[model samples]
Target chain A: MYFENFASLVDMGGHGIYVWPTYALGLLVILYNIVSPMMARKKIVTQIRRQAKAANNRKKPASSDTGRKVNSHEQFSANGQQQASTTESSRTVNEGE
Target chain B: MNWTFFHKLGSPKWFYEISGKWLPWLAILAALMMATGLTWGLLFTPPDYLQGNSYRIIFLHVPTAFLASAIYVSMAIAGAVTLIWRIKLADMALKCMAPIGTSFCFLALLTGAIWGKPTWGTWWVWDARLTSMLILLFLYFGVIALRGAIRSATTQARACAILTLVGVVNIPIIKFSVQWWNTLHQGSTLKLTEKPSMAPEMLWPLLISIAAFYLFFTVVLIIRLRTEILDRERRTKWVRNAVEAGARS
Candidate 1:
């Protein structure tokens, strides 16, 4: 070790305040770079899943009149949810592109 | 030059598949190098004759400063390729690099200020080197903002490419700033044409740190680029299959 002991290493000969904070900030930036993209990846995956589900729903329609009404209502709500989430994801993905 | 490789470079799907294999290797190498370099720089290297322990900041500062300028030049080159060839993948690279470059620029500024506090007796000065670096940060912000503001991809790419090329002028200015004018910031210690002024013990760890930082940048950029490819090509069959496979896993 360059220093004699732990305390002195942390003290860094009275330059600890400046040196430590710089390293801390550097760590923060590095962590942020890793994290922000991972979050973006999650957002994109969610969007793709939502779209695939919607496409599957469209391909198979309900048969009975009662079933159609219930299915229509559920589909309406799902579409609303997908629209809200798609807008959010598209904004992030657009910034990334 | 085989045109097949040049043409293949334009394919986002091919790049995505290839980069996925490279990612883990790059990440492991980057992490190992950075861990070794930081440990050596912070714990093993001897103190400077004048700056004492505070000089340790150079390990982080120099690498980030090098990245900040290097990434800009790369972004500009990507921009040039995009403008000339109209390659979507190149534009994606150009766009994705902006935020990473911005973060590094911010790091350079922050670390420079921190190092200055003890060494220069002040946090900041409106000197040539400092001001030009700040401008580099703004250039990154402008590219990112312009990308967000423009809706059409082609227009956004064209405009950003023009801006990126124009901003290339500042890089040479930043490189020569300390020499051209009187400045508080010191001149370059490491040079391409000659040996570094620093001792081998200090220089070796610094060289390792610089290499590690570049590898780290590649890892992050590739990750971001992969995400860009997926998002842009979301409607394609391969993307759907990939997403379904991901869902299954």
Candidate 2:
């Protein structure tokens, strides 16, 4: 705004070479800071989901073997709740004991 | 003193939930302030009498330098909390701060070098202030490397904390290097106890930029800390539920 025209603003009174690159680099650094963590977050969520899915898959067959074929869906839900509780207890025990 | 707040911070899940609520506001404020400051500093602010328009780099240089040192001090404080309280959240914070701090340190060095070419007529120098700052960057690397080398989380946290505390001794050296010894790098323009040498137009945008950088650091730190919390607590029920819900959505 201080400059009279667009050319002067870009020229920065002949210091544009130094000034512009510095600002450009600064912008790059700021963008990196924002983008890096979001990428990491995406990777972490995907990993956690995969692990959760695998754990559910591993428990599904065991629950089916113990319950009747007709009630497999209900048995699976009950087994999931039971598995979650057991894992919670085991985690506490591992931490405390 | 009400110590409940301090105790609550010890819980990673609580911190994660609270930081999630705060992140959007902080990120928005940072973006707005930075955009305002950059526009004002780059175009509206007048040129320096001695250095001319190239002095505009100060807007980026000063904020990055401030963040470089400030982030290290914070990492040290978080390190102390981890050491004393054995708070996993504090360790998580300390771990997350390193890479962010390192990037800021790199920026400060890079900007200073670029500014130096126009002002001091050289891109690099081995003077006291510059050397101390370079050492600070190395110290950041040391902490990060130490963490990576150790496989045990408990051991890694303890070692990184000690290294951070040790590296903090360099901070005061960096602060005093310009005054204590001859250096091409200039002394502080903005001071806490006295008036800054800069004019109001230049100073105002610099102040805004500093605030914006701090807010940006906080937003990023919180985001990193949340990811760390989820990673460390993945085996817990809350994390399992959260991840499952996230996947469903």
Candidate 2 ranges with C-alpha deviation above 4 Å: A63-97, B1-4, B247-249
For candidate 2, write residues A1-97 as lDDT tens digits: 7889989888987888899999999999999998999888888788778767866776777564533432443243311222223233212112222
Q: Per-prediction DockQ, in order?
A: 0.29, 0.31
Place model 2 in a CAPRI quality band: acceptable
Per-residue lDDT of candidate 1, residues B1-249 (tens digit)? 796788677788888888888888899999999988888998899999999989999999999999999999999999998887767788889988899999999999999999998999999999999999999999999999988878666788889999999999999999999999999999999988997899999999999999999999999999888887777766567877888889311
Score chain A of each prediction against the true chain A by TM-score and list the results.
Answer: 0.62, 0.64
The per-residue C-alpha lDDT of model 1 at residue B168 equals 98
Worst 10 residues of 1 chain A by lDDT: A78-87
TM-score of each: 0.89, 0.89
In the range B40-90, model 2's lDDT, one tens digit per residue, is 998899899999999999888888899999999999999998788777777
| Candidate achieving the largest lDDT | 1
